[model samples]
Target chain A: EPEVTQTPSHQVTQMGQEVILRCVPISNHLYFYWYRQILGQKVEFLVSFYNNEISEKSEIFDDQFSVERPDGSNFTLKIRSTKLEDSAMYFCASSSILAGVGEQYFGPGTRLTVT
Target chain B: GESVGLHLPTLSVQEGDNSIINCAYSNSASDYFIWYKQESGKGPQFIIDIRSNMDKRQGQRVTVLLNKTVKHLSLQIAATQPGDSAVYFCAENDNQGGKLIFGQGTELSVKP
Candidate 1:
């Protein structure tokens, strides 16, 4: 089965540095999303991208965060400046409108560690 | 405050036994619900989902029950095996941009 895949399974960066987390969503999906989970907390929605624009975002998705679909298959999340609290597992997910929005397929996730 | 939460933090069961995981949602407007399984170091894998219009839905060896009146959902696994051990999370679809509001996960440990 086709699945969502992410690059740089683990990322380590300085607090003030910028970092980009990349994801290649399932081949034919139209909608993409990003979510994060603190070490012991529930996964929280960050942002959703469709048609090259942000469709919806959470309060947690503040000024520091941006998402891009630079190419047909590559969707990325960039943090302008990392904070210690930003360290968490970031996940990329994709879904087809035909499959119902609730049926999202998730990638393994990229573990971001900022020091 | 819209949130989905689990009843228990951890559950241990013997092999060949049945396991039922429960979830509670505070959002009455949430119409779609999904259950996901996450093994160690992996992402949440979609298991099954149900719509509020229906009371029950079933997949192979797995069944999901939704009670919109009580604002509750449950996932039942029959004849659980070692592979069934994982953290399970219940999510409610926000109906916009396909955003899912997830619940705190319940850890299932199958003792073989």
Candidate 2:
């Protein structure tokens, strides 16, 4: 199975610092997404990327958050100014165009700890 | 400490027993649903999915049942094993670019 992969399994950054989380989605996937899970909470959608543009985003994805597909294989989420509340497990997911059925392959996730 | 999967609804079952987890979704427009399993520190792994037109879908030892009328979804694990211990989440898709909305997960503890 070709699974999504993420770098820096764990990230620790000071408050107000910039942090970028990287993901390499399945090679053939066209749609990408970002989500976060606060400790002991349900997963929340952050943003979705397709064709090098943001397709959809949640309120949680505010001005501080941005996503970019700098190259063919790498997708990244950058938080301009991290806050304590930004500390959570950030997950990147991808799916094929037949995504009408909504089966997304998720990476192991990057644990972001903002202190 | 607030660990992942720690505050989720939990079900304890003996080895070889069958486990059924239920979920209630709020969206009537959702046309797709998926079941995912998450280990303590990992991301959600896709297990099985069902389209709105289908009432039941099966995969390996798992089965997903969907009821569009009541907006309910259920995952059935047959002859559960120790490795099946994890948090299971049911997610609904709004049919818009495959964005999934997850429900509060249920923790399954298969006692061996």
Candidate 3:
């Protein structure tokens, strides 16, 4: 089965530095999303993208964060300045609207570590 | 180190036994409910889902029951195996963006 794929299974960066996390959602899927989990905490929604614009976002997705579907298959999340609190596992997910009411598929995730 | 579910609940079952995980959702407007499994170092994997119009849905060796009146959802696994061990989460789908709001997870441990 085709699955969502993310790059750099793990990322480590210094506080105040910029970082970009990349994902390739399943082909032909129109909707994409980003979620995060703080260590052993519940998964939290960050942002959702569709039609090349953000449709919904959580409070955690502040101005420091931005998402772009730079190409047909690539979706990326960038942080202008990383904070220590930004250290968490970032997950990318996608689903097809054409399929009508199906579940989203998730990537393995990118573990972000800020020092 | 901080623990993810130090305060969360856990269920232990034998390999041949059945396991049932439950969740109490907070959204009444949410029409879509889903159950996901997350192992260590992995993202949430979709197991099964049900719509608000239905109360019961079943998959391969897995069944999901939803009580919209009480906003409760449960996942039942029959003849649980060692591979069934993981943290299980329930999520409600947003109306607009296909975003999911996840619930507190339950740890399931299957002993062989």
Cα lDDT tens digits for candidate 1, A20-91? 999999999999999999998888999988889998899999999999999999999999999999999999
List model 3 lDDT by residue over A1-41, tens digit each.
89999988999999999999999999988889999999988
Per prediction, the TM-score for chain B is 0.98, 0.91, 0.90
Q: After superposition, how far is residue A105 of candidate 1 from its true place, in Å?
A: 0.4
For model 1, residues B28-103, the per-residue Cα lDDT tens digits are 8888899999998889999999988899999999999999889999999999999999999999985644889999
**Runs of candidate 3 exceeding 4 Å displacement:** A98-100, B1-8
Ranking by DockQ: 1, 2, 3
Tell me, by DockQ, which candidate is best: 1
* Model 1, runs deviating above 4 Å: A98-102
Provide the lowest-lDDT 10-residue window in model 1 chain A.
A95-104
lDDT tens digits, residue span A1-115, model 2:
7999998999999999999999999999999999999998889889998888999898899999999999999999999999999999999999887466547899999999999
DockQ (model 2, Cα): 0.64
Using Cα atoms, each model's DockQ against the true complex is 0.66, 0.64, 0.54
The TM-score of candidate 3 is 0.94
Q: In every candidate, how many clashes are there?
A: 0, 0, 1
